[model samples]
Target: MNQNLVIALAQVNPTVGDIDGNLARARAVRAEAAAAGADLVVGGELLVAGYPPEDLVLKPAFIDRVEAAVEAFARETADGGPAFLLGAPWQMRGRLFNAALLLDGGRIAAVTRKYDLPNYGVFDEKRVFAAGPLPEPIPFRDARLGVLICEDMWTAAATAALAERGADLLLVLNGSPFEFDKPDVRLDLARARAAESGRPLAYVNLVGGQDELVFDGDSFVIDASGAVMARLESWDERMAVTRWRARDGVWVCEPAAVAARPVGEEAIFAALVTGLRDYVDKNGFPGIVLGMSGGIDSALSAAVAVDALGADRVRLVAMPSPYTSRASVEDAAETARLLGAKLESVSIEPAMQAFGHMLAGLFAGRPADETEENIQARARAVTLMALSNKFGHMLLTTGNKSEMSVGYATLYGDMCGGYSVLKDVYKTTVFALARWRNRERPAGALGPGGRVIPERVITKPPSAELKPNQTDQDTLPPYDELDAILRGLVEDERSIAEMTAGGFDETTVRRVWRMLHRAEYKRRQAPPGVKITHRAFGRDRRYPLTNRFTDLA
Candidate 1:
């Protein structure tokens, strides 16, 4: 029996389409593991090609480059340091599959393909790659390791088979995306697998944002008895090394440090910060510029931006219209001052007058109504966009999920931006996040310590201020009720009757259901944002732009 072994879990951040950079990152981590005397270094799924290569896997040239890079990195193991267990898109006999490779002794020692390809919500792996047959335990030095890809661990078939085959350890490579309370779900699943197989398990997950999805790197190890032996930090890149020993023909992971995981609003806030930070940094944007209307939505957006990219990189512009209140202006200024971000006042009154005059002739006798309010919103949009263009900064939209659920948002007005940090965050969660940020600054946050958002920002009535005395409640239900209703309609996919049965008014349910379907066209054009909920607007819940079917019954 082997006296001792060391395994290092590499929680990495890889950009999709940056094949060379991804390989370089793997090499750096492998070197770090070698310096720490690790016997093997395990990485997250598709670390070579950067998880969910999407259609990039379709290109023969892209696959060719990835293969060459993996082979090259495999050959580097000839140095006799630490062996690497890596993941990449592999081509075997005219078909592509998600695979994990064991690199040792200067060659590819073993290969295991992913048996389960997830196809539901935010995952379309079935369309891109074929599912491989059930994987067998791969042979390493003294241990036969049971390997499960991200989705493979969700089911029991793979784990049971590997355990029956006399495998000594279970290793999982994951590219799991972040959702509210998903960390707990993953932990529960891992514990179940460990208890069923009677084998200790090691899980490695990717970190950082990819497009609208963010991966929380909460890599952890569970003992055979379903106890956590080691846990890594979440929302950041880290490399955790665990020591193991073979005792009485069974492998036991020696007790190691367990880092605390964020919960509730704290986890959601970290996801927002990580998502926005990676989106701006990975896309090569110098900084971000957004409209600060002193409303809860924009105030929270500014605080997230300042925390994500620092105050210097965040520029806040107050685009006040005639209907904008003095209290709102003061709140915006105060929020900026607290966050230490630069704020510039840009009145859209001139643009409003120009648009009013430009459309006066066409309006003829039409009385001013929501059309005027839309013009005001568009005028503000133009002002913020001009600054974004001149300063080479990406525009950050601040509309929350509640406004977007119905048709309350103006398309091409408040919806225009390079990215949105709060797109998936509901109005109710927005208030919670604002209050949390004011009291506590998250770890690795670049913003100030005490309070980034003013207390008044959270307490004030939520409004868009597109017109005089405009509050969100005038067009939509109260946020708490609206979010609960939306959770049933969108997340739970319940019918109007079902929502009504769930203690909501039937009329309000019908009205919300209609607006949700009618606004599909606008949502299609909304910018990408952090997906914190199980059912975000983009890839998570896609609806047809032209549809007549309603769940009214």
Candidate 2:
């Protein structure tokens, strides 16, 4: 074999329930690897039914379908070419097990069960399948390979057992979601595992967005000495092939060099575009539609939509109200023009006046209040829904995480959409991305070519422009301070006492903590958005809405 053993890792996007399509993709990738003369090829975790299958894994019929698919796939691999290691659920002895199937020459080589099914933070594997026994190393062609599923490599005992079992290399398949610096975190883990076990490591990750999760495909292989040898590109469908040579009885992996990683805002922007595109295309949606506001959030969402779906596929409607400013109207039109998407201006002023005039008697002497504001929002919602129904487009919402967290968004107003683009992004990140997208060209941009957002959109003060002279800071804290507090409490899990001790104003912390707790209902009803962290609302983080527990704990 040319004095080397070649291995290929395929990180391709797969839809959740599209069983036949996903299987076709797997077979196609396997054929590609075989064509490349690879001795072994690996797919991401749960290749049959896709990852984070959630309640679908609980159904007996779905499990049967998965088993049928797995068996069929194993049979197809009998062409006797390269060995294949893939993920699937194994129904055995009246109990379901999260499993990794090893296929060679059209026969079942080994079925390894995952030991650690992550229970917390964007994972509910524990709820779906029973944990399997510790995995054993499978030997093939002068090397002992240890196959571990997504959460199995995260635990100590799994890798420890593999090390003690005289394994020559560690290969892990994952459906890990994307977050800032998540790739670096995964690399650090890989390095540590390699150094600790004194073996080379191969990490193959899935690439796609399923519902709220966005899987970033930045797979890599590291040497026994804990050095990266090969890295696949981020948020892309990359197939990498490398050879390992047993030099002096030590398995050493040699891979081709790849390009550098993206940085900061560019990195995040790329992830968003990739996530949105995959979610839309893989889900079989015809196109996307959203109300175009002049705010940075909508402007940036439009930019991302154009980058994800072509401009022709993204329909923008400038739905204005009495509260919408002239500058806002101009900016919204400008954003649509820059994105090259079809634009239609439907003034909500007439609808607003009609609703107000109709409800004048019921609201007599009540004066102007949040109810009035909400009515304005609902009218716009009806109009948007009408347009969406007539045009057969998937409505895209533009609420950012900060506004979602604080319950600053109206339920039937800005929240009435099929998909949310910026629901996971904080307001601070929204501003940064708007500025970066305007000043810099994002990776994989598919719009008219130059900068999508104008400089004035980023330079201008952040506002909803729902009312005359309206600023977000009027009702909400500064974006910088609010994002800091959220990261502390939400991500880092800092207690209220700890947050106050960390230099935050005491009253402010307590007040914000209450708002976060009270806003649970709002988040519960909001449409699912991209999840960039280990913990995201609706799926990952399940805080009790009626609970009395406070951050004071």
Tell me how candidate 2 scores on lDDT: 0.83
Off by over 4 Å in 2: 1-3, 550-553
TM-score of each: 0.99, 0.96
Q: Highest lDDT among the candidates is held by which one?
A: 1
For model 2 the TM-score comes to 0.96
Per-candidate local distance difference test: 0.91, 0.83
lDDT of 2 by residue, 1-553 (tens): 3346899998978887767778888888888999999999888988778877888888898888887877788887778778888888788899888888888877788888988888877788888899998889998888888888978777768888899998888999998888877878888888887888888989999987888788888888999787789888877788889888886657888867664777688878887887788778876777888888887888899999998888988988888887788888888888888878888888888887888899999889887877878877777788888877888778889999888877889998889888887888888899888877777766667866677787677778887666778888888788899988988877787899899989998887887788888899888889878877666677777777788876554
Pairs of residues at least 3 apart in sequence or in different chains that clash in candidate 1: none
